[model samples]
Target: MKLPPIGSYISTSFIDWPGHVVAVIFTKGCNWRCPFCHNGPLALGVAEELDVGAILDDIERRAAFLDGVVVSGGEPTIHGSLPSLLRRIKGAGLAVKLDTNGSNPSAIGELLNEGLIDAVAMDIKGPWYKYERLTGKAVDVESVKRSVELLKSSSIDVEFRTTYVPHLMDEEDLRMVRRQVEPGRWVIQLVDTRLALDPALVGTASPERARVAEAFPDVPIRG
Candidate 1:
């Protein structure tokens, strides 16, 4: 099977999956254009292809050490051949976690149905009203909602993440997002505007992690 177009990879990560070591794969291409996304290059399809086969081989050799592999993006589900890529990781006896912008519920379902993915990290771009503004695309908010429900319905360990881009949204918007993603783990990521897709957003203020944590209480804030 042909590999997914891999943009870049992290050989190991401790913070990505929390309490587990995993290699992170950043796939090429994304449907949305979040100005605050750190992965702007990968998302905009401006990355050079990596030797995916070699990366997989390395992961295989190091499988005994790594707890899993995280297939992050650019939006992994956008690729039709994603299942085959995950299948390879599973074959090497490694657990797999997928990161997505939550726009493709069907693809998520297909992977879960096949037992290809062990966990999921889906982003909640913003409150319904500001979806298009935050995503910088014509978003089908319903599809994102469907993906949220699909993840919640499954036994999969799911973490719904939201980056608080103060310029695009406020605390009230975050509250609305918090309300939508409750009864599950939700993380509020402080925007790293320096790496934003839009350089214009550099130095855009994001709330302190402690302040955000106090606001959301029990929910974790990441930056």
Candidate 2:
């Protein structure tokens, strides 16, 4: 069976999954090109590949200590083999969390319908109007909307997040996102410019967590 392209792996992470330790598997390649994206290599498809068998071996050994596996990207849903890979992880008796850009609602729905993933964290990069601008690519706004609605109504746990880039995003933009994903958890993440895809965005200061929290009093601000 063909395996999902595994670009990199993190043995352990406390923050990727709330209240649970997880091993993060980074998939290669992404459809969008958000300027502030820190995982440039993964997005550009330049990251080194790992043998799927080796990765599974490691996961099996660490299963006793791990709560789950986080299938992050470069946009994990882009891979057609993602479902198969997720099934293997689930077969190991570990929970699965998927991090996506919300560009592929069909894939998200398939995974949810098949009971493959336990949680999902999707990036809501501002409002629909600013999607292309922020993502630096022509995007299908409708597809994104579909993904948002799917997660909101699904049985799985979901969190919609936006990287708070000073000039690229603001309180108004986040408010627009909130309106679309109402009654759903919206998290505002502080941008980390240390290794941005767009070199010019490096070193740009992000808004303070408290300041953003004050701006969107009902939302959660994370760094």
Candidate 3:
């Protein structure tokens, strides 16, 4: 059987997880086409060479120092066999974190229900009405809703984040997203167009911090 494609890996991280040293695995493929997505290469299903055994070995080498492994994507849940992969990672005795776009509720539910993931960071692309505009595709709004609802009610550690872009992340859209989800760990990140796969996206301005703060007075927002 063909294993899921691995796009890229970060050998070490301080912020991917709160306090743990994490090696982030970027999986190939995504359903949405968010213009501000820096990992456009992965979003387009492009894959570099993958070595699962080498990855596992690297994880093993850092196992003593690292706290967990985060399997993010272009939409990791898009792969039907994600749970099995998570299980393999878990067998190495490291925690796992999943980053998703909230488009695949069923897969996320399985991961959470089966205790395959320790934390989940789901993205709220935009308000329901503007989801298509932000994603550059007609997204399944109901599916996104279901995923958000499931995560909000989940016992697992969960966080909701939005990549802050100038034209994409307007004040009204930000407020709408905040109200949709219950008060919890909400993060609004500034989009860094530099190093983005799409060259046209580079040099575009992100929303100013003051404007973002004005939109979200209490919620923590970062880049």
**lDDT (CA) for every model shown?**
0.90, 0.90, 0.84
Q: Model 3's lDDT to the true fold? A: 0.84
Candidate 3 residue 180 C-alpha distance from true site, Å: 0.9
TM-score of 1: 0.97
Q: lDDT by residue for model 3 over 77-139, one digit each (tens)?
A: 889978777887888899999999999999988888899999999999878998987888888
What TM-score quantifies how close candidate 3 is to the native fold? 0.93
What is the C-alpha local distance difference test score of candidate 2?
Answer: 0.90
Root-mean-square deviation of each candidate, in angstroms?
A: 1.0, 1.1, 1.7
What ranges in model 1 sit over 4 Å off? none
Candidate 2's displacement at residue 186, Å, is: 0.8
TM-score of every model versus the real structure: 0.97, 0.97, 0.93
The list of candidate 3 runs beyond 4 A from truth reads 195-201
Q: Residue 72's C-alpha lDDT in candidate 2?
A: 95
